[model samples]
Target chain A: MTGVTISGVGITPFESDAERSALELATAASEDALDDAACSLEAVDSVHVGNVLTEALDVQGGLANAFVSAVGLEGVRADRIENTSASGASATHRGVEAVASGASDVAVVVGVEKMSDADTSTVTDAISKLTHGREYVQGITLPSFGGLAAGAYLDRYDAPREALAEVAVKNHENAVDNDIAQFQKEVSVEDALDSPVVADPLRLYDCCPMTDGAAAVVLERESDAEGVHVRSIGSATGTHAVAERPDPIEIESVSRASERTFADANLSRNDVDVACIHDAFTVLELLELEEIGFFERGTAWEATMRGETARDGAFPVNPGGGLKARGHPLGATGLSQVVELVWQLRGDLRGDRQVAGAETGFAVNVAGFGNNSVCTLLEAP
Target chain B: MTRGTRDADGLRVDEAFRCGDCENEWYYTRNRCPDCQSATFSTYRLREGELVAYTTVNVTPPDVRSANVLGLAAFGDVRLIAQMSDDDPEVGDSVRFAGQYELREGGEKRARLTGVDGDG
Candidate 1:
């Protein structure tokens, strides 16, 4: 709805307990973004906050209000948007609209989460409540969906588990240079296979960790620098209960949203120079790539097997390690994708991690089990 | 079929609810038909299903102690996540609608359109 350009982006380390509080992390990120844009905090017209599991994990609520006060964007319209893991992108979508629709001249959108407060088991169970209550809440964890989907994909394609392993290895290798990445160490296929199994066919390396981090983006109707413009953004919802999907293996929301976003931008998938897809699970990397039409059905994994998605491969994907290696702090992940793309488009990243001559980039953020998804296409001016 | 949440004897497993207006059928219990949003419905019991996909979750959180074996089984018009009784479930297995079995031996059982109960 809104024609917005992102002029500044800020991100914190994915693993640290630094800043101590969600609001503090968010304020710091916002400050960095404003400073990056050479704009004062008072210039922000509105504030949008994205977060999930905050009360359960961070012991806080009304985060948008807290952030506005911290940033001196007081009395401006503020809203907290949540769509599970897609919260960040959803909030970005709202901020973009707020500015584009003449509602706000400049909107400060931030996605922050502090997930380290709770233990792993408690945090895992807390997220289970967001899944299909009829089944998933009982026995199947989110990684179980990855395992089941991996089994189905391998069976459908007659492929081995190596394709999934390749995603973990490649993303980890990419993360090695990402200063803000949680895991700096690269992983190997053997390491992934030999790691303890969380779900059959998916090992420790195949899963993204629960991280604590914050990411911020400054959006305005226009930009002065080599800003990345929001070409198009599309959002859609699939079946909340994944088991009830007509095609259990396909993420229809990602497919539909990606198509709409590209169509909105009047661009085709071939125009994309880079992408940041949600890889919360290793199997997700393949499934999302296939559903989003980057690679044909049953072939994305094959491409990965050949290093097609590596930083130096045919089409670079998740050069900043993705959620798998970058560490997904729930809400921070989606906006973080946009940040990585902004850096790539501006050629701000280092040589090895950057996509060469990247003029356009694509980012996709997915909610629980693909229940909902938001896709954004970004282009450099 | 009824809501499958109760751990006790679940509703009939073989029987599935179909919308009277739109002829849409779904496995899970719902107040309104998802297709036409019609509340009127009829029930049909299917004998068996074709196992589509399955996985075993070995490492889980504290709440889940045992390895979780779950699968998607298609019974005519709809597919549902069912707890697999077999340790190694194969896709396309000719699984009968064995209904929901309680985890405890001789525990009260409710039959929902889940999947085949293991040797129990």
Candidate 2:
């Protein structure tokens, strides 16, 4: 199979700015990407945008085209890809496939979400719908879902509650060096421990905040590219409903996707120079590390607290601050990870948090808890 | 189990047949009946399973309870999600179906599963 290469990528600093619409944010990110690639909108062949709750946000339809038109790429063929929180990565995957299959010489992918415009309850309700419709009607929101997984992980592994706080502190400390991070200020483990509880075993600090942002990437065939090569891309799905899962900590989708990606790239976890796994919640990062075969079962939290995933540690995870601090704008998060990976692989990161000598990178994007997952591998050519 | 039959609501229902010819239990939503595959089947009350997982839906759907609990049980090799009985359920609890409940103002009718009498 032909390889796909990412020529350039860009992301907006996550913040609460009601003045800018979702399309505007998307266009800005796309412009940055096109600038980095030394190309104009007229040079692009196709566009793929990722969005969630655009209809709920009263955007009606034509959101994908709206992004293209706003970016002055009116003649480009465009479509939208929505897979809940993983929408961004899913859209990136589609754009990659388009380039790999020779469907388009240059494909542009953008992921944007404007959730702050919606009321808190409405946004929570819309996000909750990502779960089983029937199950969500009962009272299961994302926090509670994470809480359940936390409870199970705590009981099964006897993991200390303090370990979760440590995860938060590590990510926040890493974010301190990230200028664009939403929560760049460092927080102590004590601060995390003292924070009010949103759900049992999950404090306010343990969860990612609601964010609005955009990320974009420019992809081309390997023969046509000038930067990092997309070594492999793998995606898989699991039971949509949390109640249907056999074990919340052992998400089959992530495990399968990571395995497929590694196999396709002919690499293992040991071959990876750096990684950025989804960390929507603290426990999620731990579980994902184990699921992606980084740490053994029941040892992720322990490894994390021991500084295993620290920026300067042996295996740095989420060097871009993760969703915990980098901001999880839902639809934009997956592509944002890609942007960070590109910077790391190119040795262009201008911060104290850059991963040193990151030659090969892996990223995992998970949607709706453990329902839908995708893993992509990239190597500097 | 019979292959084609419509329920009162016009929803298609099928029965799983066990042996070609024998008195066996027919199952709904199964590939084959446990007792007789005579291809003949009938719907019967399915009971016996522990709630392996559950989630309470905060979002209300029609007339359903605002905090309705959804439970998943592993009966034999098949695992399915079912509505919880009257009592609140936790993960790894046991539950059984009682009877059908009225649908919320324009929602599909559902059966209620109650906590069983044994310790889970």
- Give all candidates' CA lDDT scores: 0.83, 0.77
lDDT of model 1, residue A127: 79
Error of 1 at A195 (Å): 0.9
Worst ten-residue run, lDDT, model 2 chain A? A131-140
Would you give me the overall lDDT of model 2? 0.77
Docking class of 1: acceptable
Candidate 2 deviant stretches above 4 angstroms:
B1-120
Q: What is the C-alpha lDDT profile of model 1 across A149-232, one tens digit per residue?
A: 888888889998888899999999999999999999988899998998877778888999889999999998864333789998
**In model 1, how large is the Cα lDDT of residue A324?**
93
Model 1: which residue pairs collide? Answer: A2-A100, B9-B109, B9-B110, B10-B110, B13-B112
Across residues A302-322, which tens digit of lDDT does each residue of candidate 2 receive? 999889899989899988889
Clashes, model 1: 5
**Model 2 compared with the native: what TM-score?**
0.84
Shift in Å, residue A34, candidate 1: 0.7
